[model samples]
Target chain A: MNAKTSSPIPPAEWIVAGMGLLVFTAVLGLMVWDAVAGDQSPPRITVEVDSITRSGDGHLLKFRARNDGGETAAEVVVEGELPASGGETETASATLDFLPAHSERKGGFFFKAQPERETVRLRASSFREP
Target chain B: MVRRGPKTLMSRRASATHKPAPRGTSRHFLRALARAFAGAIVFGLPLLMTMEMWWLGFHADRGRMALLFILSLPLLVGLSHYSGFEPTFGWVDDVVDTFVACAVGFVSSGVILLLFGLIEPGMAASEVIGKIGLQTLPASIGALLATGQFASPEEREADQKRFRKYQGELFLMMVGAIFLALSMAPTDEMMLIAYMMTPTHVLGLIFLSLVVMHAFVHAVESSGKAYVPSGTPFWSVFLRITIPGYVIALLISALILWAFERTDSCGPATLMGSVIVLGFPAAIGAGASRLII
Candidate 1:
């Protein structure tokens, strides 16, 4: 007993120091990990118009369904044109759940001139959302 | 008979007492001043230091621009010392010195750290580990505080009091980090919880850094006044504290800018504020403590 416990330093001090070092190393690793992993992706929308003719001729804008994000986009829509007359597109008329992240979902609508008699209103009623 | 070493009991008993208001004539009033004004001026400095940034950010919002410019006026009060780059006072100089020391420390330690990360198995593994370490500053600060890394006491009595008194500020810093990360994280996309650094963050970091470093440097410098042991160089101590912190700041800044550009209305303020508020002070505090000592 005398030989083994010769050192008079408090036993707790060593214990405290050891625990502190362990915690420090653990935390140092965590800081590095958090730096890489923390930021949650933000909501976004990217349009994919398969084809388009001319600005005057107008074109039907289509959306590839699927959020191109870590998480889903809350709501997304396309607005290709707005004629001077007629009713606009509404959510009831458009696609839903068409876009998922990392995949393409096809959604589309036609663009036609109002024929000069009445102007058609082409509002963004066609939407595919999160 | 047992040869009783120098009675450590006296020192232990002395430290046991937690008294009110720091003692004696060594400008303890200044400590009080720190406490009193900490809230008000701490409130004011971040708005000031980053005001130039704010002006650049929302030049469109004329009213907001005007408001920020006005709110941060008092922040420039300490400009003479900061701009002069002179260590006019003992403690004040320590603050500036720690900042410089940290920069030096960062460069040296970063090279070593980069090497550590590149060492085959450790590189991939450490990279994963490193990400975990970056969550919040408290965990690191808690470690540093626990390590007894702060500067040595000139008069042991006063130093102890100072440590006890400011422990709240440190704990607050810890709490602040959690709040900042939470608010900045995408809990709800509609968080308008003062996402800017608001000068509060900068001042808090500065004061906390100064406090911790002042204590640390004093401990190392004053204690070693008698003798400096082998293998412990001033530069290495400084670097050990600095490298991790400065690297964290730089990395956070880069990430903030990247995120800002990538996302809508995801400005640099939140990230900057979080770094300045959450990470900066504690890292600096811990760095100041360890390196100074």
Candidate 2:
């Protein structure tokens, strides 16, 4: 309480408090905006076979998936398949744990045969709403 | 050193109350800023690196996130009251320090998350705030605790003396519980462990939490007379401190789970199971605070 002693509210404390209040207010405003006017749609995934490259005795089928919707997609199952000569299929899959809205996840599957020559199909099997 | 509790409120009310010696002011702002930076890195880096935490920030319920922020206010106040980075002379000063710690935490989280590309401009407003806000809890606590941990020996000694009060002890336990609980809250493992446990295992865990809480507090108390006394009736210590510490740990675990939306789809039985599973580590952290913090 003395004049020479530290004040209960120091000048520097005010600066710190102001900075904190500014951030807190900005964050709160953003959150409020998201709550009131944000998008509430679910995640929509589109899977594509980007490229087929040759690997050792096999073909590496590169694939990519994009989440173009509002929410996140969890455990997105992307399946790549090559129909074989005997009506059989060689399938490889990759499961992405999470893919946020407007984001992309790249992954691939490998086939023993040349995917460029074989009937290769890449598709999004399933995804959960995260 | 004098130990007093009831006198604290009275002395605090009086305008003429004594203040601890002021820390030197030649580089006060710079020193505080540096401490806050150090605290943020020490406490917040792990959460920033967690992929699940990034996922949770976007998908988690926004209402609950706001509620968690609301709850953090009082917790910060309590932390400042007991072991803040700077010595506070009154409630108003404590409030100011709490804000400062919050600012440091928010800035630190924003910078680090941005550097990691966890937050992108393309993301929604909620996503950015949620990510930074979630990390702020522990970072702010670290900022508040920075003073005591990084202070000169004399100042550290002075702060240690303040921890003798009952409320101070409780606040320490809460900090420890929150720190440990939060470290694992964003992981799938908590729910995985809950699923693996039978009802009987949950009961066993509850018993284990109490036992450990009691044992650790007893050991800390008996080892030093400077600690809160343990010579009183055994039942009193067990009921007053140990039980309450375990309860605090359980509540902290539940709060963390709820904030992360781990309990959204869970039934009440499963929710209780999850709390108990996480409560085990939380209780241990609470008890171990006597030695660690």
Candidate 3:
């Protein structure tokens, strides 16, 4: 009969090694999947007017722009327009940088005119590729 | 009469004392896994609870995140060399231990995040992966440190090789500095403190780093548990141990800051500010490693 029946390295170590290999391969695969699946489409920016609330100085017109596409948008310009009772247009704008795909940025445009009495419009003006 | 060779005798002795039975092997693995998980919790729980880390995971650059993963390979190898969770004799064994620790880290991070309700089915895949990946680093280090800190003396002695040389001591300090600096690297407060500090404050921090490192070594020496015996005068020990340790801590601090992209787009002064700010913790970690390891 043989004096011993096993290898120098223990079976437990082999099991641990197998687990490690599984994790490494899985993480690598996920990274590859992310690289391939990301940035396939151009960024589509949409502006949504969330709320108009009264601030101490004026009415705060809070709006957010959502990027629905698969790429990042930089220097995103969003424009807000308040129609006046006197038939004139008042405008405010804000710029956001490096807004990633499937993400949103929120900002507020203060207006002296009461937004509840008039129409408040918010739109995506322009966005550049980051 | 049967003939018994030296190989047979050696194998018999090994099996009798060192080797476990087949059924015991599986049990050993389960216990090791449990220990690793516990280590992950003990060391990584605070970072897991941090909201800033969560935010950083989501907002951090994906490219840098990938780079950090790539850079981590060597650190794992080194950790496995010095303080692996299992008895490893060869390169392959060390590599295996490194991977096992990583797997433990990954699973622990995922489980904790899931329990916290931070991970949801509707979340973006990138976000989910990034958060888990970022947390895996600290958790993996914790797993590596667990065996060193908790293993039975017999089990530890099976693998413990005394790192008594100057190079080994320096390497240990580097590893400890990196580990400790990492705990604070992901926070927003690093940059905030850097921004808030004046030039005078930066000088004070540098002085503090040196003084603290020296005092730690001095205290250890006075306590008579000095790991590396100083055979020379005060100047020699100061130059060899304290000054070099502080320098390594500063370098590690700078490297860690750069890895976290904390120094990105900053001027030299600001970069130095961040490095010195983080160096405070790194230096303490460096000094304390001597006593622990």
Candidate 4:
């Protein structure tokens, strides 16, 4: 211990230090509870269209990808498909960097053909374990 | 055990000139807190910007995170003992400084994450807490080190004098190892590099790490901030400091890897390889800490 201080500590400084103690205790408590009892379910991803809007040459399909489980999903690929008149399906895909457990990420796909709400099919194609 | 140095004399003279009122004391604390914020940003920016760090925040093993958090209190206390934002007189001051550093770490991390858009509105509380909490330890250490990093030469000498004991030296090495390891351990590249290397490469890397660590220690010693007393045998210094320092680095690397969940899926061989890969930087950090701190 280097004993150099001679002045008494200010009350305001002590109050701030007390607040810091509270923050540390709360975070420590949360971490302990999470470690002992929190869920560890694998990622369960669900993709849904949020809105369809027009871009320059194509319509942009904005979608939300939600992770409903307790693990994070990475490189999440979502696909949107629309059935064409010629019987071929028009497919557009988007990738999200990460969808943390119990969290949502927003992404968009572009399609030249306008997609109807009922006919547009959106699905989370795949996700890598993170 | 009090070593009266120039710093003490300077402080005494200053106090004699003007008695420090409560307002002055509070203002001094505020300045230290500001320095802590700057230190947190300087040391924590890389991890704050790293993508793997963000992902690990949510998915990392909670038990390990808790353990890391628990370990950080003592680490910060020890660091505060050496070079806190301000000089501390006792254990109570050291503990108070530790918490204040943590508070600075948390606030700095939160504000930066928000500015970067990593923490968005309506985000899960757990995710936000996880990200901020995971970053807090390293940033707190940085906060504790602000004074050492920015001190006047005389003040730095005084601080360094307090850590001349063997235990104190080793503790500083551990802090250095953890600081560097925390920044590098969360990356996928550690695994990828380990996977790409053959056994011969691993052996080569092990030899290189030891040589580099020893070289750093030797350089520091020759520069006159000598940890090795004069007339000490070469092999004795090597055995006493360099070897143990390297071992501490390796252990820290392994611990950090486990904390980041990088070892969860790997086999023993891969795990060992990853540890060695990370150990290189940790060794450098350990060796260089003597010079830096």
Instruction: Give chain B TM-scores in order.
Output: 0.25, 0.86, 0.85, 0.90
TM-score of chain A of each: 0.36, 0.69, 0.74, 0.88
Higher DockQ: candidate 1 or 2? Answer: 2
Provide per-model DockQ scores: 0.03, 0.34, 0.20, 0.58
Q: On residues B1-293, what C-alpha lDDT tens digit does candidate 2 reach at each position? A: 13334544454555245443345352565577688778767878888788888887777766677677778888888878776776666787678778888899998988999998877655655667778887887788888878655555445556667777787778788888887788888899999999988999999989988998888888878766224675867898888888889999999999899878898889888899999988988998899875555
As a whole number from 0 to 100, the lDDT of residue B17 in candidate 2 is 55
Clash pairs, model 3 backbone: none
Candidate whose DockQ is highest: 4
Identify the superior model by lDDT, candidate 3 or candidate 4.
Answer: 4
Q: Write the per-residue lDDT of candidate 1 for residues B52-82, one digit (tens) a residue.
A: 2221221112222223222212211122122
* Pairs in steric clash, model 2: none
For lDDT, the strongest prediction is 4
Higher DockQ: candidate 1 or 3? 3
lDDT (0-100) at residue B77 of candidate 4?
Answer: 90
Best by TM-score: 4
Pitting candidate 1 against candidate 4, the one with the higher DockQ is 4
Kindly list the per-residue Cα lDDT of model 4 for residues B203-226, writing each as its tens digit: 999999889988888876766565
lDDT of 4 at B211: 91
Candidate 3 chain B: worst-modelled 10 consecutive residues by lDDT: B1-10
- What is the CAPRI rating of model 2's predicted complex? acceptable
* Candidate order by decreasing lDDT: 4, 2, 3, 1
